[model samples]
Target: MSTLTEELANTDLLWDVPQATLEFLAEHSAPRTLASGEVLLCPELENGHVYLLLTGTLTVHFGTPDSPMIRELAQGSSVGEVSIIDDTRPSAYVIAKETCRVFPIHRHLIHQLLAESNPFARNLLQMLTRWLKSNTQRIVSDRMQIWELTDQVNIDGLTGLYNRRWLDNAFPRLLTQSWKKGQALCVLMVDVDNFKSYNDDNGHLGGDRALMAMGEVLKTTVRPYDFAARYGGEEFLILLPNTSLNEGVAVAERIRHCSESKAVAYANEHSVPGITVSTPLPNITVSIGLALNQSDSVSELIAAADAQLYRAKMDGRNCVRY
Candidate 1:
């Protein structure tokens, strides 16, 4: 078998290191053997030494040892260097992928090498720079994936509008902002009038087209700062900031008229064979309930608007109520 200094000379991190420095490192550091699945470093634990892999493979995991691997280290790779350099705990778990041999260089010895050996310092700095770049790219990729997933979760697939889940998460923040700024905030509960009867007459597909058209109308009718979301089947909600009771009523009337005049185009199910035909569906109307924020509570504001909606539905539908 070769001497420890000869073994150290073959490793990438120790390459070009002077013979005396290698001899000193070999004399001070000891070789450690780890079994498969052994934890070499953990985020919650302090690591005082940098490890140089001499045989087999190791893996880095962010959350736990059994979690998906974030990175892999080969025989020439080094681990636990960041913790020693920054005097901080490890940021992730390093595990032995299989039976492996590593040389554990203590922090004091690493500092000595940095001060005494120019080649060792240069090699370490190069390794750290590469690691930094790799980590930055990984963080950016993760953020993009998280944003995509959040958008998918918060949007309604059928109407391409914000869903109830998004509204629930956002309403409290909007309410807080209004309270802090002392600005008026209004809530509108808009419901499709005679929706069940319309569904019975036009079938589910026609009803779906009508709802989609209604969604487009709301998106275009609301102000740039206003928020619109699908509250539930056949119902939608809108939030208007910096608006009084009068302005809220005016906005609600606009939505009601827009819904009443809008005609949806869909494929006629009764079209003749071998030819497709497009037909305009009958117009649909909406009953809107408006309420200004008086209680300074999200649930209270929504409840007040919902109560007005019930009144609108009771008073022969197709009208705005406050």
Candidate 2:
């Protein structure tokens, strides 16, 4: 096996350096062995040396040691360079992914090499540039992943509308804003009329398509500032800010009308092999219950709208009740 000096000579940081310099670095640096899962660096602690990975792998984690790793450092990769360069605590945790060996070059020696060796300075700069580029790409990729995950968590899969989970988080904040501003807010609790019968006749797939169509109608019909979400199975909720009961009722009527008129087109699942057929589903209607915000609490507003919704269902479906 190669000695620590030989490994140092092959690293990007010491490339093209004189043998005398490499010998000096080896003399000053000490070899350290790390077990798997060892924490090599942390944001809360200061790192005084730059570590050169001689064998095995290391992982960089942004948050905690147990958090998902953001980057992997293989053999020939360097660690703790950023904190040494900036003279600050490490910004992330570096942990050994497996049993590894590293050469730790102290900060004093690093500064000495930077001052004395032109090649060392050039190589360090190049290494830092590559590190920065990779970090930038990783950041962009992570952001995109986070956005997609957030969308998936908050949106209903069948309807393509915001799900109840999103509503639970958002409705309280919206209600608070309206209350603080002393502006009117209305909640519409909408449900599909005789939805079980429709599902019984057309099957669950058809019911899903109908819900998707309803989602689209709400997306197109609601004002820009209004919020809509799938409350639960076959039930949806709409929030209109700065609107009175009359305005809420008008919006509900429009939604009801649109739902009644729209026809959902779906592929016939029972189609014969090798032949595709598209059919328009029978039109559906909605019962809407509107309640203007008279209470400060989110639960109270929702409860009031729910009561009205029950009334609409009792008064015969397909109409709005306020």
Candidate 3:
């Protein structure tokens, strides 16, 4: 069992606390271990305990449990402080990415420390200020809005990926940055093979599910900095910054294989109130076209990818063209 004073000494939040306060904290805090995939905190939970991470990784997600991750915290980082400070339910989910060891500082201990120790109080104030600033920046960059109207802007509601509007605005800037950095830029246009026929055989609802699955595949396959969008309908676009054409083609093939082996499982609605049936969709295939940034303009690069996509469709669907 690691003492709280020893743990607090390594953490940023308690860096400047006096030795006495650290001793008090160590005496009050207890060691805790969180296993991988365990949720440490969530929105509805009103627990007023903040934790100091000792080992492994934790992921913070806003909105819902399945929402996009906003931050990843490592050892020596603090978790749940915002909720504790605000005296409100957590607005985010903190999940352990791997096995984690933590020391939890409950609200009562925190209040006692703050009342007895001026240095501890000051350190907490500084930490809260920095946390607020960091969170504000993330909210702006993520386009995660609190209001309803601003929510319509950056993301695709159906796929939960960046929308065409975001792509249109971001691509040019990405291209410029790549050029300035002398890095390769690769673009891929992906299309679901025999999608129209599948839609005809299945319903539009089936088509929607197929599209959503494809979006998820793309989301998982791309790098963190890579931009992916549902470029309208069954067509999806991926932008690979600092990636060679060869690397991009390889990524496309990996996505292709992943999609090929994957099945979409859905349920059927029956007219009979009590009856329901489950269906497993056939493994889906996608045609991919990859292009390196060969021209000065973003439009030219997209057009090259489009041309390659056409070529892929022509050269027997379910293939990659570059």
Q: Mark the regions of model 3 whose C-alpha exceeds 4 Å error after superposition.
A: 1-152, 268-277
Tens-place lDDT digits, model 3, residues 1-322: 2455777788866777777767777777677999998999998778779888988899999888778888899898888877777798888899999999888899888777778777767778887898889978977865645544554787898888889998988899999888888889999999999999988877887887787778788888888988889888888899999998788989999888877877776657675789886577766799988898875589899899999999999999889999
What TM-score does candidate 2 reach? 0.80
Best by TM-score: 2
Model 1 clashes, total count: 0
Worst 10 residues of 2 by lDDT: 1-10
Work out the TM-score per prediction.
0.78, 0.80, 0.53
Which order, best to worst by lDDT? 1, 2, 3
Q: Which parts of model 2 are misplaced by more than 4 Å? A: 1-7, 18-20, 23-48, 54-70, 87-104, 268-275, 314-316
Give the lDDT of residue 288 in candidate 3. Answer: 89
Q: By TM-score, how accurate is candidate 1?
A: 0.78
Runs in model 1 lying further than 4 Å from the true structure: 1-12, 15-31, 43-48, 62-64, 88-91, 172-182, 261-281, 297-300, 307-317
Q: Which lDDT tens digits does candidate 2 get at residues 156-202?
A: 98888899999999998888989989999999999999999989999
Error of 1 at 228 (Å): 1.2
